[model samples]
Target: MLLALLALAAWRAWVWWEAREPADHAPAADVRIEALNDRISALRGDLRAQAQRIQQADATNRVLRDELLGMGQRAALIEDSIARWSDPDRHGAQALRLDEAELLLAMGQQRLLIAGDLDGARRAYTLAGGVLSGVDDPAFLSLRQVLVQERAALDELGDDPRVRALARLQAFTSELDRPTDAVPVASAPADASWWRRAFSTVFDIQPRHRSLAVRPADRGDAMAGLQLELTLARAAAERRDVEAWRTALTRADAWLQRLWAPSPELQGRRDALAALAALPLSPELATLGSTLEQLRQLRSVRQEP
Candidate 1:
């Protein structure tokens, strides 16, 4: 009986000890281990999050590096292109350089947009506007500057029309500079006023030769000539280049800009005709009146483009 009681007491003590020690407990042990495993799993999740952030940052850095590389190459090309552009006197170099500038600017903007740097892209395009606005190229400079100004204005306002407009303008510039022929424009010599005859003869007789870029349709020069004449005539009385300007004005497309002053020869002829008319019965006066009446039928006229 005593032995059995001792054994029972020992058994109870062992069970109590087993309940207090975590590894010795069955269901309790499993619960503690599971809690520890949950803590370790949370830690692993945090570590993975940090690693993902680092990888994303690295990817972003690589993208920025590549963009900078492209920008560097483009800058070098622009420098090379500008050597001829700045000359101002080269035949088509200005247009070519400005065209290159436009393309580079677009490429830069594209890079910015793709990188999600909208503000940076806007600034780059605005810089392009300023750079291209003052280009001294005669043919397309004014038109291009206008387009740039409009583009900048739209971009500044955050309007979405700017990109589409820019694309169209670039295409226009490409088409405008293409090569064509230079052909003669024939106007009647007899219809010319005495002074018109002197100037018109120059056009009527320009070797009828076409140079590399001169085209039969290059009315651009004719239009430019007219613009030049109007510009000159505005300051004619105050200009030192009046003679050169005046000589150029008389032969300009003749239809676009009118001569401001009557020809001296025409004035003299009119005076002579008046004197002849004053002679009571001079046959010369009758002949002169009759000639003026007939010549009025052949006044110069313009053909629509």
Candidate 2:
């Protein structure tokens, strides 16, 4: 404001001075006005150039600011990655344990759900427990508890009466290889009169027909019969039929007795059969339902960050 006012005042003073002077000063005043106009024009051009330079500088500064911001963001990302990599909890023995536990859990699930093998499932569950024992995270602790429960449930399922009976019947099929017991035969009186024996031989009519005498059980037939009985027992156990299972087992034992002589091994097999027959027709699976699926879901959840 002050500069513009001063310039206006100077211009007015010059005009007044020029008007008051003689005509002799007219040419000089005109020349001076021309010089002043040229100076103002040059000053205006300089001002325009400065303005353009200022604008360019501002644009460059904006670009530099954006680049710096991007670099800062990249640096932050690198630092975060480094921190994560260097974290002790995410590597080494704990990491390996977590991986092994997950693998064992998966194996246990496959054995239980797909193969229906309780022993295999238990083995896998036990191994998982061992792997997870060193991990102290709350997630891992919960996982361990789940493993224990599932393993126990599997054991209970294995001990189920129906399952036990089926196993026993299957095992009984192996007993067919034993030799058949010798069949007892009654002999004719040796003290009988010689005339009686001679008369019987001459008439071809004897007190006992040789061909009609009892014979030892046929090995093939006994084995086949035993197999059939076992099949029946297994089916009955599957069907949860108590009386049918008992009858099948009894028939199987009778076949075994015919094919195997009385001995401790035979007696033990019979005792096992009798024990299975005494079990209930229906047995509870006991906390086994969905145990594997729950464990799998837990494992998946814990694996996430």
Candidate 3:
């Protein structure tokens, strides 16, 4: 306002001076020149203020843009995490990760107990329990619950406790969640020799003493893996997803066939596989003979055990 008023006053003074009849033309020219300079000066000052305002606005806009970009990135990450949690393929992977985490917790607590770190062991076991909360895969659930118990036991036992408290494995759990699809390893239960009867009771399996007649040397081997594959093959049978069924069947058969096929050099595993394969398929066994044959042919063309 002051600059505008100054400009107006200067213009009026110049005009009045011009309107006054001066004898010399030089006086009139000098008055006109001074008025032109004042107008230029005012224009320059307005342009400088406008430039500063523009720069400030640009800086503000840049900050806003950076903030918006950060928000977008955060949203994208959340979407990816949601997708992973809900994906069918990821169900198995998530379960696997949780299983690993539980095992780690157990091992950590066991160490703490050994080191005489009772409180640390207690916290570790608690965290381990939390990791498997709400998880319902039967085999894994059983094992996870076992781990929870193990954690508590570790807390109960003080440093270098009697008989290494875990020696009996009453609280031991296996990594397997469900009975495997393929074949069961005859002997290896999740608990070492320490916790046999207790584990069977907890998992609702027949007593080890009784199963001994049927169990093989590698009972707990990849029995779960094999059984799972067989189940997958059976599931595909409904849709007659022949190729997929064949893939699964072939995988199961090949695993068994590899055990005790013709080559005596690798006799033991081949023998086990043959025995397992010879057993009659359960009532839920699929009737996809052609699919099974296709798998056999594929395996045959590849290599024998």
The most accurate candidate by lDDT is: 2
- Candidate 3 on 119-231: residue-level lDDT in tens? 56566656656665655545354545455455545544554322232221111112224443333333435665666644644443444433222334444444544567666
**Model 2 alpha-carbon miss at residue 177, Å:** 33
Task: Show model 2 residue runs off by greater than 4 Å.
Answer: 1-22, 103-127, 136-139, 151-305
Per-residue accuracy of model 1 over 168-215 as CA lDDT, tens digit each: 323422433433244324454587688766767475443333231234
TM-score of 3: 0.29
On a 0 to 100 scale, what is the lDDT of residue 278 in model 2?
Answer: 84
For all predicted structures, in order, the TM-scores are: 0.24, 0.38, 0.29
Residue-level lDDT tens digits of model 2 in 1-305: 99999999999999988878868788998999999999999999999999999999999999999999999999998987887677565566776677677778778766555545667778887887787788876765666676677677677664545576676666666655555544322232468678766564344342342322225447557767878888888887776777888898899788767655445666788888888788775534555534346655765564445
Error of 1 at 121 (Å): 54
Local error of candidate 1 at 221, Å? 63
In candidate 2 the C-alpha lDDT for residue 180 amounts to: 50
Model 3 misplaced regions, further than 4 Å: 1-23, 88-97, 100-305
Whole-model lDDT, candidate 1?
0.47
Determine the C-alpha RMSD for candidate 2 after optimal superposition of all C-alphas. Answer: 18.5
Q: lDDT scores for all predictions?
A: 0.47, 0.70, 0.51
Alpha-carbon RMSD, each predicted model: 30.5, 18.5, 28.0
